[model samples]
Target chain A: MTKKLMKGSEAIGEAAVQAGCHLFFGYPITPQNEIPEYMSMRLPQVGGTFVQAESEVAASNMLYGAAGSGERVMTSSSSPGISLMAEAISYLAGAELPVVIVNIMRGGPGLGGILPSQSDYFQATKGTAHGDFRLLVLAPWSVQEAANLVQDAFDLADYYRNPVLILGDGLIGQMMEPVEFADSREPIKVLPPKTWAATGHNGSKPRSVINSLFLDPEELERHNFHLKEKYDRMERDEVRYEAHGLDTDYDVLIVAYGTVARVCLTALEELAEEGVKVAMVRPVSLFPYPSAAVREAAAGAKAVLVVELSMGQMIEDVRLAVGRSKPIHFLNRVGGMLISPDAVIDKIRAIEDGSSEEVRHA
Target chain B: MLETVFSRPDALRDVTTHYCPGCTHGTIHRLIAEVLDELGVRERTVGVAPVGCAVLAYNYFETDFHEASHGRAPAVATGIKRARPDLVVFAYQGDGDLASIGMAEIVHCANRGEKVTVVFVNNAIYGMTGGQMAPTTMPGQVATTCPLGRDVDMAGHPIRVSEMLSTLRTPAFVARASVHTPLLAVNAKEMLRRAFSYQVAGRCFSLVEILSTCPTNWGIPPAEATTWLEKNMLPYYPLGVFKTPERGSREPLPLEG
Candidate 1:
């Protein structure tokens, strides 16, 4: 298939169509409105339904209902919008329904700025809602990867019968890049039968119930443990990452994901030109978070830099991965800001000269 | 052996219920089951259960079920019905679940004219949380939270769900009925049947609000709760059909494109 220039949000919407997703329920939010915009024009052309829900919470419940009826469905929102969806997301996970959600995150703890920021790292990777549940989170570093991972998201969600998240920032959603969708005629992977779908009962098929409530304490415990097992398996088999310039023994290792990783890649070239050795590990999956790969990439490095678009949220995860062997550094550009390569190079020089104290406090 | 003059509806599973004594939730459930069974739509019907007293509605219904979040059952039912138009879908919700937190969901769903049915049970008070105030709680009605009686000035007037729904230009059917007496229960059942019938005919949105008695929460006997529902609740929330479109109706609804 020929590639076409598209905004990241538009590309993600087309990718959902290619993946045979036919239902979309979403509320309009900044930096991600293009997704619902694109879907509204495209889904109806293909005999699918695109409902602009009354609220993000309602949209997520619509996703839950569509997924419960054995259909590939998706919803997209920004940060505060996603906060409203947290309850329904937890319900989807607890019900063991397969659905895909995309977070084109913006800045915030409240109604933060509408510009690009990765401040939602903790919310997406950690305690999302009131339950012992995990969403298989995928991070896309580029527009093309955004399209590819979205297709994978639907397949994986159906395969595991669990919710999947594609976590991007406002930068990814707003940026324009060339993206090629898979040919629509190309056959998709055959998934296991969703025998539990509440589709309807003919005489041949028994009635199905999609429920998350367990009044019995023991039964609820068992259900929770079963979910734990699924997450454990995802952690083992779904972890993915990319290593750049790791072969040559590097003086500093930079760990990042999503848009920050792309910026860090450019910074790596700048640092090398200045007679400094730097490598990077960009995690592709944030939940089953390529921890082992990060540790290996950080091996024998004198120092490490955890760069993000937030106020040092992902730094803790990198700290857990690399441990106390080396001094870990954090570089961030928060509140709808981006870090430049020159600033990154300055941080690398400071850390190398053992002026890490000044940079850390900065 | 006694003659089997009455038998349990095929759509209702034969099991003991968890409802408190004198609670009319069981009666409403039976009405829904009977309607679906009589319509011969049991096989293709899917019910969306609410988060209040009827939270376990999925357990009593024999067909497909989806348990929605608090007040989000209408949205859930919209998703299910739109995806599989061949199936009959209805959302079962209580007063607090539908009229309070779910108010936005139900109103938008009705305005969109989604082809689905809503079986709403309004008992004038929250049942599951030990009877706090609900959106449908009447003026001067007393509950655990509204210990001083519902002040019209402070709490605002109780919402008339059926009347409010009928004001929308989209929904095909909107009715308010009570199950206080056997005759009234039969009347509520006919309204339910009509609502479900609209869904079966692929009509627009339909909702039936059934005024029920919550004896435990009302601080009265089951029989007195029935009379109280008739005397106190019925005057405020009149029991009648607010709107009914021509049968098998369909029209374009604004989806906020």
Candidate 2:
């Protein structure tokens, strides 16, 4: 009913609870610990369960189990912890189970740092374990957006019978923001019944088996195609992005997401004061990546600038989307380094001055 | 009219299993099916099958099933039991799956006193992976990995999982049984029944570690595999109750000969 100022991680947990997600399985990792901590305190009051699993490996499997039984379940962790969950993620994808996973990204090749980084963009969108399957990835730029997307993640997961990942960074996890959950607790969409759940037949129906193993090669190929169809549908129907300054003439189009996108918005305001028109496209869904939107936005701009917390991961997608139609530039801060608005303004100014080469290697 | 007796358990399907000849997995499956039928929980039971020789265990059971990754069956079962406390849940795992890769999941599940049943089959070797050494592999016993007899100096000593778990502070039903012989097979069924009964009553975590035989992996004839288990394996892994709610003390029951 009333807006509550909450930490991003806590808001994500509350949003899940409001969405009727009663079961949470998680292992402690920096930056995202608030999620499980909040769940442990809040779930029991709502007659739900929160299990602090031994490791990320076990926590993800617990999700597989709970989801197999037709319950709305979720888990959250940071970068390395997410890596540990890769195997189970593949299994969940293969099994076509509906579960929500949140990754409050820190830095990494290993246990990098506890500060914000978007290095896991590729991990979330591309190689999330060995699979021909894909997880519907949603990237939220603010705490309120993170809360809203976590709730949407449940519905999207159920709608497609696939795992949906809420990809946030450490900043989004730690930053406090006012989030308004709907007063009337109703799901955003009506979902199909989980008739395939392994909740015991009770002799009235046939037994249900939740499995991903396909020994027959032909059967496995067909299963892969079946999953491909779901992902294809996601790409067609679930593409979401926010385009700013697109209605007016702009020279530079910035492609960014999550926290970096917010940073770019501030840089956009400063650049506009300097008479440099900079339009931006912030992708909301990372997997069904607003490719067409990026292309359409890039068509009107002289050059495209891709910003991220990682070196150059999402830039690959941007390049694919724009495809040499215009000169594309890259800017980033890695290993827990935050990209300041001044740095972004400098890059935009350099691009406008045709001195982009000076900052290209910067 | 002719009297009918000893038909297949209602909880077991009629399809043939992929197990090699003389593998005791079939016996253990039957024992579990019988227990589910006897307790009248067949309709409300969800079984989590591990990734080993019993990877296709879901197909053998008539109840609802979930196939879990290697060593994650306990975690999976914990999810199911916690989500729907009304349903009966169990995880069937093997030596490599439970005692090695899944060691942390099993120990924590037991320590937390999760209300679920675990059927651990310890054949002392990895069957599906082609006779590799396992965490419970007996000392001086040869495996494909340990070609020249397992040198305890090189490989660590075998883990007595039931005994180790019995020392945990939480209340649970932990026991070691065998299905190498008919007498032991009957005892194993009772032990399995007790394990499931504990979960049915929502008592605590329960695990029945059944010492099984892998004739194909052991490089022995099926009949001689039982003799090998009795003569060699039994001494190290004795059959007995390791922990029970009635027995408050942490000490295990006396080792059976």
**Chain B TM-score for the candidates in order:** 0.93, 0.97
Backbone clash pairs for candidate 2 read none
How good is model 2 by TM-score?
0.98
Error of 2 at A233 (Å): 0.2
For every model shown, the clashing-pair count is 0, 0
Top candidate (lDDT): 2
Which one wins on DockQ? 2
TM-score of 1: 0.96
Listing every candidate in turn, what is its Cα RMSD in Å to the true structure after a full C-alpha superposition? 3.9, 1.7
Residue A262 of model 2 has an lDDT of: 91
Give the Cα error of residue B196 in candidate 1, in Å: 0.8
Clashes of 1: 0
Per-residue lDDT for A1-362 in model 1, tens only?
Answer: 89899999999999998889989999999989999999999999999999999999999999999999999999999999999999999999999999999999999879989999998888898978989999999999899999999999998899888999999998889899998875654433468788899977665777788989998999999999999999999998888889999988899999999988888889899888877899999999999988898888888587888999998787888888878866788889989988888888888888888877522322
lDDT of each: 0.89, 0.93
Chain A TM-score per candidate? Answer: 0.96, 0.97
Off by over 4 Å in 1: A184-190, A358-362, B1-4, B247-257
DockQ of 2: 0.89
